[model samples]
Target chain A: MSGIVATIIAKYNYWIYICLMMIGLYAMITKRNLIKKIVGMNIFQTAIILFYVSIGAKRGGTIPIIEHAHGGQSHAVEAVHYINPLPHVLMLTAIVVAVATLGVALALAIRIYNRYRTLEEDEILSRIRGS
Target chain B: MKKLGLLLVILSGALLLYATVDFPLWGDPSSPASLHVSPRYIEKTMEETSVPNIVTAVLADYRGFDTMFETTVIFGAGVVCFLLLRVLGGEEGDHYYRHLPTGVTIHVKGAKGKSLSGEFERIDMLWTPYDLVIKTACRIMIPFIQIYALYVIAHGHHSPGGGFQGGVILGASVILLAISQNLRTALRRIGEKTVGILCAIGVFIYAGTGALCLALGRNFLDYAALASVLGTDPVTARSHGILIVETGVGIAVMATMIWIYNNVSSAGRYDEGL
Candidate 1:
């Protein structure tokens, strides 16, 4: 019990990310409106980005910017001194991709709305089924 | 159906939570993430690229090819939006304008651009109040915003921002203009044609740079090969190449975003866009 408690406490941030992910997942799965589903998808993406960024965090570390000498003397940078930059770089690209996807998705949604005059999934399905 | 969705969500969430047990603790210095090649990037970036910021170095120099494709992706999105929504040829009943100056009503034919002189202002179907506050504020701030965006792109080597963020900011300025003024006013500055050309040119610049390197007997997207052309050493040439590629990315992203906004907001009619 003590080991489990320690594990939970140590990895609490991941647990929070998991909770957020679940909320987003629930919304995406159950939301009827296409736009709502898109929002849920965005939320899910944000959760994943947050999780990746959190993995790079280090206790006593600064940002990824290097502090070097003006006189051209090179100093050894300790790995533990700075936060991991790879995740930040990857997430930057991910964030841009997410925005682009959202724009395209929203545009498609507008097109669908124009065609059917509705955004509800069930209405569209029924309309397709000729019921 | 809802129950099935709920069940699926629960299963996925549980599975993900279970997977979290193997992840490193928050702020663990010796975590796998910190032990890898990122430290080398941080330590060697200044010497290699002479960039003070590691993120910019990694993004522009270390991963230039990835950024090139990302820019292409944004351009593709713009093209997709334009293709989906653009309705060529105006509708006959689309024009019903009443001149505000003299109670004169003219039914404009689908004919393009033959409005009667400055004697008449075509009234809008969806009436909108001319917001002086927003207009004045945006007018005053647009120059500063554009200048800052350029600065951010140029200073990416030393700062927190790079091509993508700067491009978004630049695109936002155009969006702000469209919002504050009417879409017609905004379109005058950046027409649909201009956006298409700019977006294409942006991608071309990126790919062209890579191809240029290949021509110089180096691998594709290798900026270092342009050293002889730039009158600089290979390292400095790489630095300059990164900057140039980043510039291409910024321009591409900015044009694509504006194009997407114009298409989606107006639904390709190019009429009063949001």
Candidate 2:
């Protein structure tokens, strides 16, 4: 049972992330509320963040920062191995991008609200079609 | 109805699951992404750009053209919003609609002893004491937030920050001001016309800098052309060019975002249809 549990944990982390991602995408696609759609988008973006961060992680790796300057020497001794810093850097930009996209999306939602005075997606569609 | 939808969704999801078999495994060091352009960038970028942050180097130097278009995307969104939702001629009184909240104590400023009638009965409190506190805080924080945003743009070469990150921060601060105060206050501070002009100017600044480099006998975005004026090495010139374009991107993004927010939040108030 313990061996099975370990195997499952090792093999299924990505699957869990994928499941969460699908749930969010499903909500965004099927929900009739604009605000709920935004919430779903947030979840979708957050899952990508999780996927990226998890990729950057290495087993038992230390922080990426270098300690003890080389003091003009060609080579310096170091006891610690550095973790990959690329994904963290990428994630910072991704977070900013996500927020900016969310801002614009929310602004669009507000405009939609003002035009039709309704939050339901189906209602807005029907009204537009009727008009 | 829900169960039917769920079944259809599950069927589609199963199809998607089969598609994932061809994808590279997560964190495979030997994957194509790690093997191709990224490794070259990781090795050569620090020496070429003299910047500690490799991501900034990639964004500002290696793939600067993409950043330019990204800024343009925000500008386009702003233009669309403006066309769709610009408010026209109307006095304050003409647009005001009043309604009372049910089962709540309503406080009237000037109508103390007057009987509740048509206009007075419908008048509810729009600006409350809590709004005042939030407005005051936003006013105090706006300048500092803007300054910090500028710092983030300038220091992006050496640090983890860059144009897009700093631009969004600046835009959010303006949006915060708008939400805490009113649309009028925000417009007064950063008017729509000015934002539109700034958006154009920001794009020009970015594109023009690249053009200048091209005219000076270098590649389109090669910053070595600015070395004569800047009195620095070609490497330093590259960093300076990147910074200039980053500042342009930040300005364009911030102005465009605020403009978009204004238009979207105030839709349908304009009787003059675009």
Top candidate when judged by TM-score against the true structure:
1
TM-score of the A chain in candidate 1? 0.87
Classified by CAPRI criteria, candidate 2 counts as: acceptable
Per-residue accuracy of model 1 over B92-201 as CA lDDT, tens digit each: 44464666667677767663655666666554466475699989999999889999998888878777887787888898899889888877778899888998999999
For candidate 2, what is the DockQ?
0.24
lDDT of each: 0.83, 0.68
What are the per-residue Cα lDDT tens digits for candidate 1 across A8-51? 77788898888888888888889999999999989989989989
True lDDT of residue B152, candidate 2: 88
Native-contact recovery for every candidate?
0.73, 0.08
* Deviation of model 1 at A123, angstroms: 1.3
- lDDT per residue for candidate 2 within B136-233, as digits (tens), equals 88889988898888888888876557676678789879888777866666677777789899988887888888899898888887877889778999
Clashing pairs in 1: none
Model 1 stretches astray by more than 4 angstroms: A1-9, A68-73, B98-114, B117-123
Interface RMSD of 2: 4.7
Worst lDDT run of 10 residues, candidate 1 chain B, spans B90-99
**lDDT, candidate 1, residue B100?**
64
